[model samples]
Target: MAEKFLQAERYEAHRPHVRAVAYRMLGSLTEADDALQEAWLRASTTDIAEVRNIGGWLTTIVSRVCLNLLRARQARREDDIDGVPQTQGAATVVDPAAEAEMADEVGVALLVVMETLGPAERLTFVLHDLFAVSFDDIAVMLEKTPAAARQLASRARRRVRGTPPPTGHVRQSRKREVVDAFLAATRAGDFEALVALLHPDVVLTADPAVIPSPEPVVILGAHTVAKGAMAAIERAAATGVALLDGECGLLMAQGRGLRLILRFAVQEESGLITEVEVLAERETLAGVEVTAL
Candidate 1:
């Protein structure tokens, strides 16, 4: 009993650190909190005495939990071709726009760039670059060699290097140009043109309110997602250019009723639009900043 109490105390000491790592990996506080709870449950049941570095152990456990969540999320999103938003409000009744509002507070620009990475790449990058986890530890978690883990981090690093430092409006003008091109192509329903405007591996994720389907849709690749973009020509034609949480995006309204918001992460290298996250929750849309087209 005494040992258990001591272990719990130690875990408490590291809880905040574990949480920050989880949030960085998952990009959702609700998911991050869930991951932390899961980690605590696992930690409480394990042989705490066997562990040396409690902090590292807790981090590894939480990261693995977050990775599993991401994989499951990706799997769930695969079938949401109809734009069904996943029903997620029952558990936590916080502000719907809280996620977008967190962008500025949590380095939203970097968070947006991180969303573009794959599960393994994201895990490797977050654990190594942000938290200073050794590649050996990362490899063990990934079931690969240290060299392989290092390589993954290196690849992610190259991509992250292109992300600007999230200056307020220094790049908004340039970003608007990219977003305009994509919108123009989307409004025209020019499949080829839309694909050309998007990165070959572009990703599109959206909230349920905007998508109005049973599950949230996450379409990947320029061609597959471009088809969806083409389908939204009417909405595209009606969308106004806006700044979502300080990043370039689109505002959608229906005769003064603000309907949805489209946030973007435009790539600097190829001048291609890489990510399009639609937030249609009325509250979320309310928080978006609309700028001049």
Candidate 2:
């Protein structure tokens, strides 16, 4: 009975960590939840006496499960007519105030970029680069030679070289400043200032489930995006939604629950905002924490 209780405690302790790992690997909450359930089942069946570090063991199991699922998904995509794997495009924009609200969690831009990698590459890169897990341990879990795992990480690194490193602690602080400016412009209905911060090649996409447009509504120039922002601001003003700071901030609904929350990313060429992305879905907001603004 004591042993069983101990095992239960260990499981509970590692549950949140496991969910985070699974979410990062799979990029889908439903899939991560399934992987977590399987990890728990495997943990329960194993003999607790042999497990020295229950947390590590559980994490390993969950990672492996998520890796396998990613591999299978890749394989299925390969068999499709186009023979190209599906990739997540740029995220939808939300109210800057709403985004300011969720600043404590993962950045939306980082999450979107993560979807560009293969499952193996993402898992290896995240483990080795983000978590500082040793290459050897990652190799063992991935069932690959250490050298191969190293190569996988190298390729993933090359893919992201154009973008700023996502793991930097300083990036978060800089992003908050950009988001604040964005919300203020939106609230004040300043289209020209809003356009000044956007990149020339900015793209805007509405939720497909909501908009059902076949193609992503790509807005090419900063001026064009600013015009659209002006229209959106007018619409939002009609609804009494105000931008906080310079970005979309708070989102309150009558009875339907809150709508889109804003999150921002600023790509710096020489310490200026280049690319800005906003994410509003609740599922996307799960890992994010909103500060009181």
Candidate 3:
């Protein structure tokens, strides 16, 4: 009984850091809390009598729990594509306002980029780069060699950092400007500005993964496209201008969950958007190259 009490006390002492690690790994506060509780459960049930490093042991336990959660999340996303319903885990009600604030506090861009990483890559990066966990420890957790773990972290770091902004290209810079203006208008809910940025015959195409239709949906004309864009004004705050496949595009996300990538085709003379492609299919999204502008 005394040993159990001592273990519980020690868990409490390390709760904050462990919870932070879980948050970085899972990118969701509700899920992070769940991971913490599960970690504590595992820790309490196990005997640690001869354990030399209690803190490291606790971190490993929490990280493993988080890694399992990340893997399960990936599986559920794949299942979603097959029309399989997924039930949520035991999670507390999340307030959008609070979540947004926390995202800001944690660097929203970083979290958004991290969402694109694979489960093991994300875990390795967060544990090593973010928390200073040694690669040796990460390797054991990931069942890989220390060198392999380092390689995973290296790849993740590159994706998170992204490529530098384009230079010496007037056309590319202009397209970026237009995208920036479009995003600004969307966030401000300015109908006229949105219409001005689009050509009269502008075409907006979306994959079925975006709208649940049997086939891809297409909308034409500036007014029609502007109205559709306005309808998604609420998403503006969560969207950002990014370079997709070396073209100006928008990456829309909600609380670290990427939803759609909007690729724009702009006419050089008119400087107006001619076509907009909305991609949400998992395969398409995975293949997209997102560079922070």
Candidate 4:
């Protein structure tokens, strides 16, 4: 009885911290409350003897629950696409005002951006970046290798740092050569080569669908964007250089299913990329038809 009392006290002390983790993992206050409640129940039932650091243990428990909820939500959305009737509250409509408030309160446009991330990407980013949780610990929760977990976080980071929309194409013929050289640099992980292709003050932006944060990740300057993209060598292997919406760029895919599009705004006279927008929202990704390379 005494031990149980101590455990309850400890759990209460950490409730706020636990709830904060849940709120970031899920944008909804109602959902965060639900996740915290579930975490409490699991913590209560867990063996007290096994937990050395109560706060860490509780955080792990709450994160795992949030991860499950995010995955289930994605699954439910997928099911709805197949005409399957979802459970009540499965497709719950978040009040637009409330959603806006949450986003503002968090000082991020995370509310809208979170919907764009895959489940694991969301969890990995939230736990590792926002909460300062270790990747090894995250890997255990995610059932992934630490390297794989790190890769997921890297992908999420790139998604957040979105590409700018391409506009004003001139000398479209030379676009392919520039893009091809860019990909070759990316594949080779050659930093100088990549930087040479970008305009001195280039801008990059991405849609919320690829980034879970409220504000889109935007990068400015040739050198900065180049160094960042150089690390994308592994992803380069999976990318196909092609033309999107009449501009030359890259098409990323998962097997035959197109998953992302990178549209470049080139400065024809200089033969440098002025803007690079990598978009992966469902509508944009789905309607993409590759132009002849």
Best by lDDT: 3
- Please state the error at residue 5 of candidate 1 in Å: 1.9
Pairs that collide in candidate 1 are: 84-213, 84-214, 84-215, 85-208, 86-216
The alpha-carbon deviation from the true structure for residue 65 of candidate 1, after best TM-score superposition, in angstroms, is 0.4
CA deviation > 4 Å runs, candidate 2: 82-104, 163-180, 183-293
Q: What digit string (tens of lDDT, one per residue) describes model 1 on residues 170-274?
A: 577888888778777776667788788888889998777867888888999989878766654355544556555556676654422356667788788778888
Q: Kindly list the per-residue Cα lDDT of model 4 for residues 1-293, writing each as its tens digit.
A: 98889889999999988888887788666678788878889888877787789889999999999999989988888878775545535433445455434544453323334457888998898888888989999999999999999999888766654443365444666787888898888878788988989999999877776556687678899998886565433456556665565566776543223557678888868989999886878777656544433
Q: Rate the local accuracy (lDDT) of all candidates.
A: 0.74, 0.60, 0.83, 0.73
Residue 291 of model 3, lDDT score: 63
Where does candidate 3 have its weakest 10-residue lDDT segment?
100-109
Give the RMSD in angstroms, all C-alphas superposed, for model 4: 13.9
Q: List the candidates ranked by TM-score, beginning with the highest.
A: 3, 2, 1, 4
Candidate 3 residue-wise lDDT, 164-274, digit = tens: 656747888888899889988887888899999999999998889877899998999999998877654355655677667777778766656667888889999999999
What are the C-alpha RMSDs, in order, of all predicted structures?
Answer: 13.6, 11.3, 5.1, 13.9
Residue 230, model 3, lDDT:
67
Could you estimate the TM-score for every candidate? 0.56, 0.56, 0.67, 0.52
lDDT of model number 4: 0.73
Residue 93 in model 3: shift from native, Å? 1.8
- Measured on C-alpha atoms, candidate 3 has an lDDT of 0.83
